[model samples]
Target: MRIFAFVGVFASVVSLIGCATGLTRAGSMIRESTDLSVRNRCEFIGTIDESERMGAGQGDNRRGALNRVRNRVAELGGDTFLIVSLDTDNSGAYVQAEVYGCGTVGSSASHAPATPAPSGREGSMTTGSGFYVSRSGHVLTNAHVVEQCREVRIPPTGTAEIVARDDASDLALLKNDIANQPIPAIFRGGRGVQPGAGVVVIGFPLQGIISSGPSVTTGIISSLAGPSNDRRLFQMTAPIHPGSSGGPVLDDAGNVVGVATAKLDPFVVARETGDIPQNISFAVSAGIARAFLDAEGVRYEILPSDPALPTENIATRARQFTLRIECRE
Candidate 1:
């Protein structure tokens, strides 16, 4: 199915761009609809708040931003949308829209669209985890986490820019706009990490469902390598959940040793091996992350292993640098 998207500008009226006047491939399916009757009949999906070229100070990237909102509407199984808000910020323009699912263009709606159950899910929003790598407010997370985002924010700090992304290594570096005295993670030199060593993972797992702060899971490095003998990863027994990607994995001394990445799917493993695996996850080695930061010219610190601290104490310190990553696409 093709997408038909057009969002009306609000009182501020930032963009002058309009919909295609004639039918094309993608243009024909999802067209501009100012008919309130059509909008009234459709069930409301949710609001899409997106920014274009945010924090870039170039002004007016509305066209690109609205296109992303349309794609997102289609992804949510919606067929039409109406711009509820469009305004300019200090750095860029943004649009907030309401997406709806009406039947075919000419036909009467057959069934009412099901609104997603309010089971604590961030509806039309995606959340992940990240940690500060430098005092300059540079953050490191999995590239996939921010690749699809139109606006990446670290809560009260506002918008962040994707300074660099490495799909090959599944790492991305983000530079936040405000330098609000952020706590940067101190990585332990790569030489000391070993199998069977105790590690702590600090992240926002399950986001809205769990406590607002970070969650701590403790485990040991199960192997020195990952699946298929990937040496850049550490196989660990710590739990990695949906919103836990890119979180910091710390050793007993409160030094970051790796970045939490993935966990095995129990059902998939069961289908392949006739058994279930539990607490089996992987994190990119901190050594690899450190190298990526260095290549990007980010000022991060790496110190030798220090005397071990209590697990709770390590978690308290690591939590300062660990943060929740909110992505709007």
Candidate 2:
């Protein structure tokens, strides 16, 4: 009886180790999205559904389900899988994906569209910033950045498709075709916006003029409203430049509270009002962004709150999802 009990315990440990190894390996090769464009070179490998046991923690359950989905795709000889949908029921967390095979070299080439040269009157290229919001490759940026653009490039990633846009809100969503998984922005839900909260901004400003890396700025949420008391906007003291549009306004907890949109034009405002506004910038509140995503039926992640992260750590994490948006008109 003692020998049998010891054997059972040892077997369970081995099984857990095997599962962890498989998940890590599978995660390294799989890419998730529903926006693959290279069907000509790849063959469909059928859809896969994966679910995992859930306890009190939804985060752990979701991660487990995603890992299972990736593992199943790898087992079926598929290099990429597009996440069709994810949901949770009373029983567990579940994810469904469509698998594809495009040969041993991988399907990255098939996923990207051919790059075209700049053309027409808006032929010049402009750069801005954006960040990923969903695991399905959905990115959020200012609509103007990609407006009338012939091609949108998210550097170190790949070409992106303009999936949705709201000119009124100055927000746009892009679907990228990259093999690497993106770290999504954590929206700060249930946390009310407060005056004088510490904030940070990350983006690629001035491109070649500055270093090729994203720049970081720190400040505080100066006001809860914007010009004319626009409650949908947050007036922050964080300095923003021309290229800073569409970047995220993150709280000390590293949760996104708003989307950097515009700043008071000192020249124009001063000419009209005879007063120069300094360090006056505005960002669309996270509530507005959440509503936009909801209207578009885009799924996103949210966190209740997080322990305050160090400035360096926050910047490092933000860089993972923050991308340089290049537009050729």
Candidate 3:
């Protein structure tokens, strides 16, 4: 055969250049192991290196690194959350970091890192995306990511004292022990999921850095309901931003149902009209996330065989733990 087809196309182009040089060093070691695992799950929030004599009446350098990150989050011991920055406001000097307190901070002899506040320099951290609806560890984010966090750290994983927060449905409900573990997610059951179906959305957006990972987006259900005096709300063409406000939307069988909050772009104004109405994105109904987990009593369990027939009365070990968690997702 023509010289064995030119040596089988030169050994398949040298085995595709040795698998593209081992996938370019396995994609730079998976982006430096996801940037050192999100800088070991952030929580530093403090550093302004003596803002020119301890922030002399703050008014520059990003207001003295936001007043030395509001005075070391009031002397490092009570923070719901913090993230001040000033990189170069004419270099008046700045860097204030602090992320400690929620319900999880590591180090049973391994994940130390909780002292480098910078000027002794170390600055760089991030770990703020959330999920896990309720199994006991609770969790549901976006009260501006722990809002006035009086103390909320989850470093290396573990921390959540916050108990209840609604903030007009911006939602929040922390508490941690990570209970039985394996808290990925699986809620759905809001019933009859209409409008075109198919969807999926997971987050970690921006928190994992430069829009890190866990991001997956697909769309449909561009409006099964909304503004009919708010039929619990729903609308999705999928593109969301601002770290995709409180994640979770899934449905192509993954469950979840909805949670992403808002989006609405449309402010066009071009004379003889050629382009007008555009924009819409809201979501919050999986039956208002079962009325936000039945107003926080949160129990969850209704997927015995679920095809859409769910009202909740289920029992029998909660329908065999919701049919073994919908057959392992």
Candidate 4:
């Protein structure tokens, strides 16, 4: 029997360049809408995570996977999806594998269309996850999505194109050939989120053909200003998976407070040898994101404006790698 459920979502937004258009305004337009749900937009792409030895036949497994996808789709209000490719080798008792894929969704319908897959090209080569952020063709995604690529394809309409990406921050900026489209996402604001607040993590985890669409999980803010080596990051207790990188982390009020970046406990060198890491996750704070945009000269303003955030803190801007690597010895 197949069952369907809704996946919940967190909130966030990002961008580059000091432009008059395609910028995300922080924390104002995030009212929960009835239209944003899995029943309306989420779709599946291909298979990335299936097990033949799990005692379930292909049909049973496929239905099980789709049900998972359906649940996630309802959570993030995402319409676009992707399949991540993995490099694996059979090891008799089990298969060893590494994850590689992208998935994305928008809070709004103004997302640009994806480019068509070329005939005979390996489907795995395509970038998968991304979300809409601006009305003028700007989309936000991990810089790794378009990394080393001459171009990338957007969703729903097969719109292929080139983009200006910033690799240092693992963030990319896409200039959609599509015109005047609004990108919907949780808004950012001057009032930063506090620790222990409720949060939802949204993304596509483990590429599976039957298991496609947005996924959501709930937890609380573990820390408001967690350390990312020398950089500051927001930490959370929400369980996350491989496909969730570069997605949104939302507050209970449905406002975007951070961008999903990394799972804290997945870095174990021996993940299978009793080295299971607790599923802690981290995100780039909205303040840091705002500073990044400011350095790039992007023209976004925070909504419901914050009077407590230091003007210097809000005004400071810089460009740097967003990933923080900390090894506990």
Off by over 4 Å in 2: 1-122
Give all candidate RMSDs, comma-separated: 16.1, 21.0, 20.9, 16.9
The superposed Cα distance between candidate 4 and the true structure at residue 248, in angstroms, equals: 1.6
Q: What is the lDDT of candidate 4?
A: 0.42
Give the TM-scores of the predictions, in the order they appear: 0.64, 0.62, 0.25, 0.50
3 or 4, greater by lDDT: 3
Q: RMSD of model 3, in Å?
A: 20.9
Considering lDDT, which of the candidate structures 2 and 4 is the better prediction for this target? 2
**Candidate 3, 87-188: lDDT as tens digits:** 433436555444343222211112233433212323222233456665676666544445434355543344466666554545555655643653446666
lDDT by residue for model 4 over 1-329, one digit each (tens)? Answer: 11113221111111111110111222211111123242244343233343333423433333344334434433444333332221223321121221211133222222322322244332222323444444445555555445434335544434544344444445555555565444455355656777787776565544332155555677888877543342446778886554455556666544457766555433221222346446467776666655555554545434553333332232121001111110000
Q: Candidate order by TM-score, highest to lowest?
A: 1, 2, 4, 3
Q: Residue-wise lDDT of candidate 1 within 268-318, one digit each (tens)?
A: 345335798888888888878888888889999887777889998998888
Better of 2 and 3 by lDDT: 2
Error of 2 at 52 (Å): 64
Clash count of each predicted structure: 1, 0, 29, 34
**C-alpha lDDT score of every prediction, in listed order:** 0.69, 0.69, 0.44, 0.42
Decreasing lDDT order of the candidates? 2, 1, 3, 4
